[model samples]
Target: MSNIQKIGNPARQSNNLLFKRRSILKTLSLAALLPVGLGAYPSGIVIAADGVPLPENVMTPDAALKRLLDGNKRYVSGKISVRDFNVNRAILAKGQNPYACILSCADSRVAPELCFDESRGDLFVTRLAGNYASLDILASLEYGTAVLKAPLIMVLGHTDCGAIKAGMKADKENVDFPGHIQTITSELKSAVKEGVKLPGNATDNVAKENVRLNVAKLKESTPILRQLVADKKLMVVGGLYHLDTGKVELLT
Candidate 1:
């Protein structure tokens, strides 16, 4: 099956119209069970596969995370999937239903798509200098989950991050970064404070701490995402992308 047709597509409803409505009504009768807590969706919910294009397995947070890690394994092995972009373009143009959402750094060295080995519509990505979840980034992530139904969110950091380094320097030396670059450092200061207490590689440690803070922020975000997480419909995770090795190490 084509990627578009892999799940029951809602856009194609025009063709069947009444028949699809009838099918939806029938499916609703079997979908009354509420989803359980954290990383699971109720089995009954999987029956109504209309607008959500993700497969039943991919709908769960754990499965979605596994898919990303598995893809990363392929990337680290230098055997990434050979994708046919031409075949997916028309389908993707209609709508997107990404399995995962990634908040990554806006560093040229760290490309989330390449690191995760995901194609065009597989991930909904938001990038910033420090990969921190600012209010704006939180809003975008909420939309990814509540509106787009992305099951998983990952805050990706990296080794030798300039932002973390700047934050560390600013905190230690009381130096100011120029322009709006200071905003990134300001956001990362708390991570620097926590990371420095932990012994080795203070800058790299700060980067990982930054990812952790953002991951916690997303999981605790009010209304939309917090409710989804409590009901087991969504998950938030953290990772550190290794630039030299092309590997993503999941941060605890």
Candidate 2:
């Protein structure tokens, strides 16, 4: 899908839409049977296909992070709470009021919605080959917070990222990349330079550093973002997605 589709997406406007709604009693029974706490939805709240509700219950940054982690645990344990996207599509057709914005890599293996176990319309996501933040990406995130009032932003990186390796190899061999691919390579070189100074694998460490670098940039960003952070109205953090375990570890 295109980046626009990955973002809040076009309005889901269909008056005739309707689908199966899980009985509240049945949902309560299911919740009681599960050992782990399923992420919260407001009482009598309908969970549409986008597993998570559009207007998330997270008020604080910590709560938002906890909600995501809770979802990841369910994903890791193969106990994903039932989501009715068909119903979600109908409910979200009018407008979306998502709570958190995610800056994640374009790796096929790393899906923010699935990893966070959030349903559609719950997250505002911007993606590229590397999880680096460029001016355009930063501008979009600013809009997400400034206009949409999203309270949290997460820069999510991952293990064995191809973009990191490509940059590492390019830096080591002084290979010149063709076309616009050079843009991502150049952005990542600084992280590779810093990563090489660390104590672990080259690409792996650089990938983590990339998340930190971007998170720092967002935290210190000017105009909208900086003011929001200063007023404690918004938070920008970093995370590393563990592909094998399907868990996201907080980095900053």
Candidate 3:
């Protein structure tokens, strides 16, 4: 091909790019004219930030919990929902309206979003080794509930959690872990003591106890979380994620 053909190809490409830009701008302008929550989003839903609408499925606390459990079932069955991250990227940039808040363990093997089969903007997650309700974690959860309007909070622990195991070991050996690792063991000491008294596997029992404690704490947390729970506007629950089967068994 001659240099002229190459130069002509560049010009056509430039024109096509300009045309795409014009189409995108036109689409955005039309979106502005449409009523809020009309085209892609449903009506009666409010946005925490401009162009970011809250989820429709989380109208009530029970609904939110059901949605979450359903997601977990899908995860366990290997039928997890397909996600289009690109589609949600622009909207999520403005803000998020996660339907639930998850206080989950920071263990590398356990991921809240994956276990729940949820994508970005679907869950507000805070993590610690023991999944305890630290003051900072509580504050973050409160923001998700009171401000972001998340309907549910879950204290999620996992089987064979390193933190709980370490706590149990510390109790048995009467030895301290190095560095800030001792902090996590200390936080879980009470649960470990209670677990030893309970039947069944001691490690799992301890993990469940830790989740229960945190669930209760979040329910009774003054002002925001407690009020929300009392009003039936929020539900706090506990769950233990099975490492082997990918099943999240809801703790009573």
Candidate 4:
């Protein structure tokens, strides 16, 4: 079986059980704690005493992805219900415990949340022009994995990435930048060089290579993440999202 299927299936089953149990317990707990006038009763419904709905807690990466895929299905099928902005906003105000951290491109078309069909606070995402790894990006990823305790770190790339295109065109004489943009292109130079020799379009080859390199970089650069991997506490994966088809394909 594929890694995505392995990670996704068990988590899906467990999350369903967890949600059912939590829902039942929450209803019972509220019913017992509230006054009779408040009308909080255990009828398998989630109505707060303050007349607000409780926020659904999605704590696991697998569950989060399932939710995203479900939302994507809804989006594709034209079945998206209007979001409960007030309820969602209120719940998120307390805090967030996102399940996964995504390192992806700054491409307008590659919004991780929208592509994954996740809501706000569902993912800890970091974007760079080429989804290149830098010290700051590594630190942020460490923060997400170590501090935030996110179970998964996804290195996401896409077809026809503009940054990769730019890297392909870069030469020693013309490699200039206003500020940090140069740094991004500089990092991507090697991937582009390596990609050009590979048998594919520069964009496609670079995109896949970038994901693989980033995943390897994360595993090697951060001791915290390395320990997590050693302990099986976390998973780092590379994926390619097909922009035209809106499909995500895991890279082994």
Candidate 5:
């Protein structure tokens, strides 16, 4: 039942994994069958095990937001149970067709899967100190969108982000970086500038603005994403994760 075992043994499908997958598919089918307010229990339908069904398609910005919000709600409420490591490992042995590409900070507190309540093979994540867009990151994102055909891309930032804080305090006389840390600080300077204009805590403001700025930059700087957006083939979104509340608010 270990994660590695579950993944390595393809022929074995745990009862939990099978049940969950079936429930997810059923929920999606039911949602499609039931119109907005016409079904018997149509006020709103909750999936089995309290897990929300991902949207049938995530090609549009609105659909992407809905999917992430559902996942975050499950995460915030402590309802995530899909981490059957063995099963996931096996599933991923074939390949990963993650539904979304996430660009997030290297902050220890901001593990993307935990925040979004996703399991292995569910997300394609690229982590850097400031969630800054670099050439390599952009190339990876292109692979996710164009090759993997992931429907969504998200720039995730969190409150109390250390990278942003470092950038904001970069003016210190003795500031020093041994390796690529200086590059991270430099990339975060624009976020720091944007954060200063907001009215609340500097760190929180910077984190939120950083997410927005990164998303904007991804859309503007990458021809692949730009073409995707223009053709309505993909969606790009920004979100801020609150550590205290375990809530993720979509910025756009």
Candidate 6:
């Protein structure tokens, strides 16, 4: 990579990046979304940021959830559909209209796009280890749901989360990292505390419980989100991503 390449035409640069990203994404087994030969989505389908079109049914929370669950079923069965990113790139370049929002972990292996078998632009996502409903995270969600009008929001946790493991160890050992790591550890530990009463492995139980905790927090969020929930315009739910099975087990 040269400095000339770094300052190249912005549009060309963006396209180059998108092309490279698609190349990488296509290689993943779970990145499979819709097969290219399916023709087009129904007349009710609309374009999203990722360039994939979402059916009108996905405009509603229940319908959106169903879409994701079905995709996961396809993923778990290893029956993935092929997608042509070259076409979708043109569609997505115009704009994005994602159907759902997900708060998930930062774990490298836990790619939500693959886990749910969603193409790009189909899901608006925010991630961090031990996915908590922090103030900044809520602000982003407010924009995604209120402005972007995504009907469903899912708080996703996963198995063998390093954040969860670290938080658990911190609780048992009272270890402290040098910087902001302690802060994130603290948030995860709180969820661990809540899940301690449940019977099971500490990290695994906390991972699921953390999702439940965030779901409740987001539902009660005021002004924008709460009102949307009240009007049935938005829904907040939770799930656990099983690493071994490549499945998202809905917690709520």
TM-score of each: 0.78, 0.77, 0.79, 0.69, 0.73, 0.77
30-97, model 3: which lDDT tens digit per residue?
43444424223324434454334545634688888888899999999999988878886866665677
> How far does residue 117 in candidate 2 sit from its true spot (Å)?
0.6
**What lDDT, from 0 to 1, does candidate 3 have?**
0.78
TM-score between model 6 and native? 0.77
lDDT of 6 by residue, 128-209 (tens): 8788877567668876776567899999999888998888878889999777788778777768888777987777898888
Worst 10 residues of 1 by lDDT: 10-19
Candidate 2 at 143: error in angstroms?
Answer: 1.5
Question: What's model 5's overall lDDT?
Answer: 0.70
Q: Quote model 5's TM-score.
A: 0.73
Clashing pairs in 5: 3-85, 3-86, 6-86, 6-87, 7-86, 7-89, 7-90
* Model 2 agreement with the true structure over 10-72: per-residue lDDT tens digits: 222111111113322343454354332223333443445444345455468777777878888
TM-score: model 2 vs. ground truth: 0.77
Error of 3 at 242 (Å): 0.2
Off by over 4 Å in 4: 1-82, 171-178
Query: What is the C-alpha lDDT profile of model 5 across 146-234, one tens digit per residue?
Result: 65567789888888888887887783443766676777777777788888888979888988888888788777665556777787778
Worst 10 residues of 3 by lDDT: 10-19
Give lDDT: candidate 6, residue 192: 80
Worst 10 residues of 4 by lDDT: 10-19
Top-lDDT structure, candidate number? 3
**lDDT computed for candidate 1:** 0.77
Where in model 1 is the C-alpha error above 4 Å? 1-58
Residue 60 of model 4 has an lDDT of 55
Cα deviation of 101, candidate 3, in Å: 0.3
lDDT of 1 by residue, 206-250 (tens): 999899988887887445677779989999999999988988999
